[model samples]
Target: MSRRVLIKTLPLHSNYGGILQAYALQRVVRDLGCLPVTDTSKPLPLQRRLRRRLWDVRRGIRMSLPARFDWRWRSAREATASQRAFIARHITGGSFVERAYTRRGRALLARRFRTFVVGSDQVWRASYADLPAQFLDVVDDLDGDRPRRMSFAASFGVDDIAEYRDGDRARVAELIRKFDAVSVREAAGVRICRDEFGVHAEQHVDPTMLLPADHYRQLAARAGVAPAPATGRLLVYRLDANDHLERTERELAERLGVPSLELLPTGGPSPSYREYAQNRSAYDLPSIEQWLACFASADFVATDSFHGCVFSILFNRPFVVYANASRGASRFDTLLGIFGLEHHLTSASSTAVDERVFAPDWASVNRVLDAERSRALAYLTANL
Candidate 1:
């Protein structure tokens, strides 16, 4: 009988990457002869939620005042519905557990699963890292009977470990030390683990890359994505949009003589841009399959999202990444470096639209990807 593996990560919300990664990790675990499950637990208490909300609101205010009241709320509601539908359709193993934010909640989860896997996202970020539940601390009282602990592609979401408070840092270190096998998503994460926590960790690719490209193609086909456009268009999946990026995209599209289609961030549509007056918006929050299909069908992609760049590479489409510093630049650096596509990374101020057309050496890129896939597979199989 396959061992029951329970995964703990950020909740499946509007974030496409987070949802897709969770699905991918589940697939990886199942392929390794283990049953992978997730906790469909609800959000924590009102106090915690309020605190987190306040922090997020503060951050949004810092970034863009308008973002605080954009169509994101409606878009997120739609996106959440779509995400739930996708999870219901694709992920088959787990059943929803009640809200599990407290000590009792962790105990209940420990009792249900023999192996607890934490990873494939920034679950270790300071904001969410302090929770004992995330660390599998509920099982600590079980003594020798404690469940197996492992992490796959977990990220710190920042370059430095010092981003956490002194107490949080110590707590996180202790929890990490208890993991049987740990692997991080970024090279900086690997260094942080080794240099700061003294825990040796292997660098692994994002879970989305664990599956082959054809897997996503099949999903797109199932979703009924239209065939590639005859007069191909420029697809823009900008998570953090600003005037400069918008102008650059328009300029690039104009130069390439292609109509532009912009996939706005989680919320709703932004103010109209004259540059994109001829452009279109994928305003209806698309399902995960549709999202993947959008990337597959695009002639060219311009994005600042980590997963957008990821899918662009998967489809072997010509693309450019406008690195979003606030969202975490290290992730882009690590992923782009893996495919030897560092040249594609550019800043918002850059007006060099012509460089976006350069074709990547896919053969060399695939070879590196294949090797990394095997290593990630080995880590999952051995640990699980």
Candidate 2:
């Protein structure tokens, strides 16, 4: 029997959370004694390619602005160098099959791999181009010999399917019904899978939480470059900027009496992460290791990022999440609810920063994490 497992996920890119989740899933699969490969090959539609080229022309104009205003500019390749390096070193086995593959080509893939695993991100979300591919429709196209299909922590990125077009919802519903097993990252996803898709799904923690803090700390240590030690510092990571962020940061810093280290070259937590890549100079962009290190070393953390909240809990750093409604607040709700830390979520308009926000019960949180980690790993072992 072929032990090769093809993981269908959002293409690995500069987003720290997305990349780390991809890495963590592959790592978990390797430990489970299967050869895991992620679909890192991104195939953009021609229309998108053309649109991107047009954006590139506008970005060039922006890049040409005076150093006083556009000082952070660096080629995208240069900015993403460290992130690419980490992926190359730790994450491997890229599958490049596109939608245009021949029947024979897909048949060959069917024989070569026996299991297709999808998830640990918003793989089910409608905004991404390859929704059917994420659902393992490529494997279904193989006809007589189809591999087992399973979703591990897949997400819809929204609470309901009302936002999705009728055609997309019906198509997604049809594709998802064929899965051997389904699991999602958020509780709302379970409801969606049941009510919308008419398929049962278990809710699991994100793959990043499957590994121990020591695993990430070792990754940061070996990566050779890190932001300066954030020990005793407040780490502020925000994907979306709002009028209230500055005041929130100021208040947190003042209350904590610590300097703040903000993750930068910032523009995302976007579904496509293209905004971050397009808008920032490479020099201003932080490496994946640097991003992980901030969580590892920080005394207190504040952010509107879901993964930021995940890492703070993973590393047991005292943190507050400034709920990012645009990026799916349900993700934060589900994740924080799992650990009984729902109080950690705050907003720009939220005036009072509770004393408890600065102090999560690490002992209790770790207990929950340990139990949840066991459940997650067991799901992989049983299903795969």
Candidate 3:
């Protein structure tokens, strides 16, 4: 069988977690002695693209208003330059193929790559415009034996899929059942696969956790990211903004006696709605290496992002998780549960910060991480 493998996951964009997970997976695969190429060829459907453009246009009109206009606000492309550059250098570049769903495309893919991996993110989520492509449906035309199909840490993103159309749910179930092996990132995902898709899936840590913190520090060094100067700063990385999360951040900062440093704006209701309010430099994404350095150097961390929590734990940084119910709270529940730090999960309404988060038992946490890392590596080695 050809050692070349193709990876299918959500398209690479500015989401730090999404990009890192793709890079981590490809790195792991290459270390296991296989050539991995992520498939970035899939494009969003015409309708989805149109809807996004319309939303952008409306936002542009609003930002253009005299009261809201800021001369320093940067364009989206300019803001995301560092992120896209990292993707080109480490994740995907000229490897992005044209449409691979046609008959000829499938034959070429089968001939070129022997394995297809479809996960480590919310690729199974029903609302994605390109749901079939994420499920590796492009290979359906080829004989099953030619290309092996599997998913590592695939996630549905939400516990419930009913919000999406029934046809999409049924089709996803059908496609999931055909995979040769399956693993999920969250505990709830295991249940969802068994109950909803009638397929049993083992649970594994997110691909990011499979690598140690030293690996990221080295990567940051190689990228010319300066070593973080010692500081008493509370790093706050949240995906969504609400009064509760704001309160939590304030309270945590008070308890830690450190000033808070927010890297991303968790806009009101939407992640990007308040983008114009910040200066142009605020909009520029920190290089992935710098992002890692933040987690590594923080005295205390409070975030609503799943990857934020993951990095905090990986770096052994004392931290708290403000539950992000929208993105999927189950991800937090399962992750914290594994290391017996469930008390660290807080909500918008929680009255007090957990004293436990101020001082985690790093010795115990590291032991659990080691075990989980070994389990995840074994799964990849055995399956791949």
> How far in Å is the alpha carbon of 162 misplaced in model 2?
2.6
| TM-score, per-candidate, Cα-based | 0.83, 0.86, 0.87
lDDT of 1: 0.75
lDDT at position 380, candidate 1: 85
Summarize candidate 1's per-residue lDDT along 1-384 as a digit string, tens digits. 779888877777678998899899988888888878875443456698678779878766654644334443433343356777888888764432333445565566656677888877887776644454566555565533767898899988779865677876677778888989988999999999998899999999999999998999798787676545312778888876567777778877887788987665333354233312333233346678778877888888888888999888888888888888777789999999888898888786665754635667888889998999998898888889
**Higher-ranked by lDDT: 1 or 2:** 2
What are the per-residue Cα lDDT tens digits for candidate 2 across 1-384? 439988878877788889999999999999989988887655456687678779989889986775345534544545677888888888875654553266666766766677888877877777754756677666666756656889999988878766677877788889889888898999999999888889999999999999999888888888775644788888888777776776778888998798887777543322123444455542446778888888888988888888888999999998888878777778988998989898887876677776787768999999999999999888889999
Residue 342 alpha-carbon offset, candidate 1, angstroms: 0.4
* Model 3 pairs whose backbones collide: none
Cα lDDT tens digits, model 3, 1-384, are 338878888878899999999999999988899889988665555677678779889879867665434433435655678889889889743233344544565567767777888778777776653766677766776744756889999887777666557776787788888888899988888898888889999999899998889999899889887777324899988777678877888887887788999867432222242554455455567878889988888898888999999999999998888878878778888899999999988885678887888889999999999999999889888888
**List of clashing residue pairs for candidate 1:** 71-268, 72-267, 72-268
lDDT of 2 at 72: 43
Candidate lDDT scores, in order, read 0.75, 0.80, 0.80
Q: Which stretches of candidate 2 lie over 4 Å from their true place?
A: 42-74, 226-228, 266-282
TM-score of candidate 1 relative to the true fold: 0.83
